[model samples]
Target: MIEARQLTKRYGDKVAVDGVDFTVRPGAVTGFLGPNGAGKSTTMRMIIGLDAPTAGTVTVNGRRYAQHSAPLREVGALLEARSIHPGRSAFDHLMALAYTHGISRARVSEVIEMTGLQSVARKRAGAFSLGMGQRLGIAAAVLGDPQTVMLDEPVNGLDPEGVLWIRNLLTGLAAEGRTVFVSSHLMSEMALVADHLIIVGRGRVLADTTVRDLVLQAGGDTVVVATDDPAELRRVLVGPGVEITGHPGSEQLTVTGLPAREIGRKAAEHGLVLFELTAKTVSLEEAFMELTKESVEYHAASTTGRAA
Candidate 1:
């Protein structure tokens, strides 16, 4: 498990992360999401002890990251895809890291195979492709089989296949009861993989909820109805809290503040035949945009930024 209680970070006069509180439980993938400059990276850095917090606290399992006797064995992190030694071979790099904790050559080989880096295991870290480097980073992260794994933009430079691979891998790790927290800009993939989300904006926590609940919150009681008698349907359904649009000029009626079943029943009572009736469902991306629209840090003014 991971906990951040009123966690905060500041630089001089700028506050990067404000007081934020959230929890990441085991056996599920938790997405860490925010727009650029929303302080997501700063929060993640504080979790791993890369940046000291100005106030509050963050803990992995039961202790701060640096307080652990064997931090890597408890929390595995992939903050950067290319943080390895450039001059060393992929195999050599893993060997050096393993040597520090008495992890064996077989263990390194296991991770190499697990990450599908067998072909490039002997290649210099500097020459590896972006996708390969990401794989290597993931290999190192899971080398200890840690109970908690946190990754920042793990699929940034991956191809379709690589993206699919990482998706399955992350979910599989979480299935083993490991706490998986990931930050990514790919909303579609986040919808498929993440069980919960922690959204931030302007250095403060905006929402921490499940994917299902977030979408539900964004959705409404709007139902789309297509009927032969549009005018009659509108007249019958017209009432308090019941809005009927797309009528008179068209064959459809967008009825808000009513369920599909209620709409169908109401139309039938008035002898109106519904060609189609569907309760509109809000997609995860749509819900995310609607929820975080106010929290977006960067605004695109126009194609007119400067005198180009």
Candidate 2:
């Protein structure tokens, strides 16, 4: 597990991350998300000991990363794929990273094959495409068989096939009981793979919970009912906590604070003929947008700026 207590970071007079506390547990893919300047990279850097925290403590498996005798065996990270040497082959790049942790040549070849880089394993790193470069980076990360895997935008340059591969790979890793903390901008893919989420806005956590729970919190289900006798149905559906809205001249009535079943049962009891009664739950993307809209640090000005 990864834990942070009152984690904070500062640069000159600017504060990138505030005193926020959160945990990334094992056995699930926990997505780390935030706006562009939300201190995600800064926090990840601090986690891996690449940058010293301005204050507070962060630990992996109950010990600081720097204290681990073999950090790579404990955790694998792929923060930047383009850091590899352009002069080396994909195989050579993995080999070099493997040698750092005293890994064997067999292990290097194994990861190369695991990430589907075998076909281009002998190709120079400079010649590989963006997707291939991402694959090589992943191979280097898993070369040591680390217990925890942290990837920042692992699917940034991946094609559809590559994206699907990473999704399955991360889920498989979590199923094997490894800690997987990933960050991605693709909400659709994140919704598909992540079991838990850590959403940050302006460097502070907005949510730390399961995906299902977050969606439920977004809002109650909206029930849409279309009836020939709209006025009669609306009169019967009126009650405390139930809010009904109409679109001016439209026949559809959107009701909140009641489930579809309840609405249908009420309609049947009142002998009202309904054309449609559907419950619509809020989506993850919508929830994220709502939560971050207020916390967004920058906003594009409206069309036609006022006189300077």
Candidate 3:
């Protein structure tokens, strides 16, 4: 598990990361989400000791990353996939990393095959495509079979197949009771793989909750009701804090602040015939936008038509 207590980072006069506290437990895939320039990279760097925290502390598996006898075996990370040497082959790169911590050659071979890098294992790292480089990076990360795995934008250059492979790999790692923390800009993928989320804005954490809860909180449960008599149904269901809207002359009513069960019960008591009563679920992207609207640093201007 990874824990951070009041972690802070400052570069000159600017505070890159404010006092942030979070606990990433094992056996679950935790997604790290934020807009660009939200201190996510800074926080990740501080976690692995790439940058010293100005105050507070962070630990991987109950100890600082530097304190571990074999740091790579304790926590494996892929901050940048293209940080490899141009002259070395993929096999040589993993072998070099394994050699540092006395890892076996068999393990290096294992990771190569695990990441599907065997075909190009002997090719120079510099000549590899973006997707292949990402694979190599992942192979290096799991080289020591670390107890914790942290990856930033692991699917950046991946195709559909590679993306699916990484998704399965992350879930499989978490299933093994390892701490899995991944940062990604893809909300749809995060919703699919992550069990929990840590969202940051600016320099502070904006939210720490499960993916489902966040969505429900941001976009409350909406119930769509279809009935022949829309006006009568709206009047029957009207109450304090309950919102009901429908287009003119439409049979469907979009409702908020009430569950399908309660709506059905009310409709039955009022002797109204209901054709449909279904709860509408919100997407993670919508929730993220709703919660972080104020925290977003960049906003594009509205475009009316094609540029001249």
Model number with the top lDDT? 3
lDDT tens digits, residue span 41-95, model 3 = 9999999999999999999999999999999999999999999999999999999
Residue 121 lDDT in candidate 1: 94
What does the lDDT come to for candidate 1?
0.90
Residue-level lDDT of model 1, residues 1-308, one tens digit each, is 99999999999999999999999999999999888999989998999999999999999998999899888889989999899999999999889878877788999999999999999899899999999999999998988879999999999889999999999998999999999999998989999999999999889988999887888678656788998778878888889878788935788888877889988888777788889998998877888889889988788888765787
Candidate 2's TM-score = 0.88
| TM-score of each candidate structure, all chains considered together | 0.87, 0.88, 0.89
Candidate with the greatest TM-score versus the true structure: 3
Ranking by lDDT: 3, 1, 2
Which residue runs of candidate 2 sit more than 4 Å off their true CA positions? 228-253, 257-270, 301-308
Backbone clashes for every candidate come to 0, 0, 0
Can you write out model 2's per-residue Cα lDDT over 214-278, one digit (the tens) per residue? 77678746889999888888899999988899976788999987889999999999999889988
Candidate 2 positional error at 6, Å: 0.6
Alpha-carbon lDDT of model 3 = 0.94
Model 3 misplaced stretches (Cα beyond 4 Å): 226-254, 257-271, 275-278, 305-307
Cα RMSD for candidates in order:
3.5, 3.4, 3.1
